[model samples]
Structure formats: structure tokens, C-alpha cells
Target: MDEDNWDKLDEEEDEEEGDFSEPETTTSTEPTSNDYMAGAILANGIIWLWLQSLQMFSGFTSRISPSILADFTAVTIVIAGFISSQQVAKRSERNQLIVALRSALYSWAGSLFMMLTSPNASITFSLILLVCLLAGGVLGSYMLIQMRINERKRKLQASS
Candidate 1:
């Protein structure tokens, strides 16, 4: 019985050592294709919002009401967040980044909605929304670039 116990302990130690000896690789950390798609959608939405905001500021409000534009932007962001959250299989750095992007977008959307609905809305609130949107866009772009790089590394590792 003592000999069997010693053998089991040796086996466990060997397994632990083996686990530590493996090289760190992109395969373990790379985001799925769904993450890539979500990031792309977020980037495009940011661009769209920026253009719409610009149009509103440039005297195109005669065609579309600002309230309608704000509501559309909010809906777009909520849909993107829902789709991106659905794509996550497990918690990971990629998932965390997506969550952060979603949060930022949601905050911007809420600010826009409040500004449009409030009687005391001012230019300061609009400027804050613009800043948040720009910051979120930059963050989304960074995450997307990181995901692309990791994917390339994974492909190269597979081919080699």
C-alpha cells in the first residue's frame, strides 16, 4: 500500500511539472472569430455615430430630428452589446475587452438620450458625449488590432 501511494504522488508531481513546462502560445489566448466580428461591428458603429453627430452639427437637422438620431444610436449600441456578449464561450481577456467597449458605448448612448430629453441640456453635455464616443472608438480599435495580431500568430504557429 505504501509503494502504491508513493507511485501516485510521483505521477501527480510529474503531471504538475509537465503543465509548467509547456510554452506560452497564442492558441490558449486567441479570441474566436465571433470576437473579431463583434469588434468590427463596434468600430463601424463608432464611425457611424461620429458621422451622424457631425451631420447634426453641420445644420442637417432639418431632415432628421436629433431625438430620433439619438434613439437610433442607442438601439444600435444595445444590439451590438447583446450580440457580442452572446458570442463569449468563456471568460477571457477578449471577453473583458468587449465588455468594456460595450460599457463605454452604453454610457455614451445614455448621455445622448438624456441630453436630448432634458430641458436644460447644454453644449457641455454634447461635448462630453463626443469625447466618450471617441475614447470608446480608440479602445475598440486597439482591441481589434490585438485580436488580429493574435489570430495571425495562431495561423503562423499552426502552419509551422
Candidate 2:
């Protein structure tokens, strides 16, 4: 009876080890939505930069003029925002800053792309996009800071 119990215990331990290993494999292999979004944004930014560089190299000075610098800045900001958002999302923390940053980045990137592709874009459209981006950035940052303060207050109360 003693030998049989030892064998059974060993078998159960092996099964437990297998269960732990399976989760590690599955979690590592599964790509989250944030990962996909970050990849897409990075790819889009790289392609845009590459196209601009090509235009400049081909003597398309108008297409690669001073405005190209602004587009580059927008791309950099958007990519950084996407990366930051992904990191924050992984923490499972709902943050307003991340949400607002994403919103602002998307608006800015889209507006920059539109302006670049259509230099004749209406002034009204440009103004609207800029306003929306600014509003989202301000609102998001403010809300997130408030949330952090609230969380700290709650924690303090609980500890007391």
C-alpha cells in the first residue's frame, strides 16, 4: 500500500508540472490585440517614412519638402504612443493617459497622412482635426490624472 501511494503521488506531481508548462506555452504563443495593433502601426509608419525618403531621393522636392519633417514627427509620436499603450494594457491597468494618447496619436497620424496625400485639403478639415486631437489629449491626460488620485485615496482609506 505504501509503495502504491508513492507512485500515485509521483504521477500527480508530474501532471501538475505539465499543467503549469502548458499555460506558459499557450500564453507565449497567443498574440494579443494590442500586439497586433502595435505591429500594424509600426509597419504603417515605416512604410510612410520609406516612401517619403524615396520621393526625396528621386528629386520630388515638393513631395519631400519641409512638411515631410512634420509627418516624420507625427509618425514618431504615433509609434511611441502605440508602444506605450501596449505596455500599459499588458499591466491590466485602465489608464486615461494611454487611451487619450492613443486617440491623439491616431487623429494626428490620420490628419498628417491626409494632408500629405492631398496638399489641397480644405483648411476647415485641417482645423477640425487639430482641434479634436488637442481636445482628446487634454481630456485624456486630465481624466487619467484624476483616476490616479482617486485610486490613491481609496488605497489610503482601505489601509486606515
Candidate 3:
């Protein structure tokens, strides 16, 4: 309130302003739907390339039974979907469901494109893989959102 105090405070502020250390880290950019779509395409490519390599190099032809292969592919798709949803949920606080669906839709399109291009796997299996992806994305996002909401509610109640 006095001139002496005001001058001291101004000097302190000046000293603090000159004390720069390291550069601050910027906030991470949010993941977009295109990222998810690109991820799906990349995953499909990896799967296709890996299978082709096995058949060509390791003699993994019809040795891999259709049922077992299809099952494995379906499981992989579900896990990818779940992981994608988890990433989306972690980065975003709202629009989790919408984002998940949009990502899943793009992922399904990628799968369809892969099947059309290669036609190595069965058509029925592709359909099953698409369903698994959509289901996993939706269910995984829902579960994470619910858990976070419940946790917030509990924290608020405890503090109250």
C-alpha cells in the first residue's frame, strides 16, 4: 500500500521475470478421426504383408486353417478397436461415443478396402471382423466413459 512496499514488489517481479529456465512443453494435439483411419489402414497393411511373407517364405499356405485364421483375425480387429477407443477416450473429455463410431466406421471402410484389394481372406470373415471392430469400439468407449464419470462423482461426494 505504501511507495516502499510497491517499489520492492516491482523489483521482485522484475527479478522473477528474468528467471527463465528451460522451454515449456506444449500441450499435445488431439488425435483426429483421420489418425484412426490411417491407423486402421496401417494395421490392415501389416496383417496383409505379414501373411504374404509367411506364405512365401515360411510355407504357411493352407496349413493355417480357415477357422483358426479367421478367429485370430477377428480377435485382432477387436483388440485394435478397443485400443483405438481407449486412446480416443484418453485424449477427449466429450464426444467420446461419436468419435469412437466415426473411427470405427473409417476402420471398417479400411477393412473393406483391404478385402477388395487382396481378396485373400473369406468374405464372411470380413463381415465378422467389421462387426467385431464396431462392437469393440462402442463397448470400450462406453465402459471407459462410465468409469471416469463414476470416479468423478465419487470424488465430488467425498470432498462434499
Top candidate when judged by lDDT against the true structure: 3
lDDT of 3 by residue, 1-160 (tens): 6999999999999888878656776576456666776656654665466556656754564677778866776676677777665565566667778767666777777877777767466777677767877876787689889889899999999999
Model 2 lDDT per residue over 43-130, tens place:
3455356556756676555556667855654455445444434433333345545554554555455556756776566776556445
The candidate maximizing TM-score is: 3
Model 1 residue 98 lDDT score: 56
- In order of lDDT, best first, we have 3, 1, 2
Worst 10 residues of 1 by lDDT: 82-91
Q: Which stretches of candidate 3 lie over 4 Å from their true place?
A: 1-31, 42-66, 119-122
Pitting candidate 1 against candidate 2, the one with the higher TM-score is 2
lDDT of each: 0.56, 0.55, 0.71
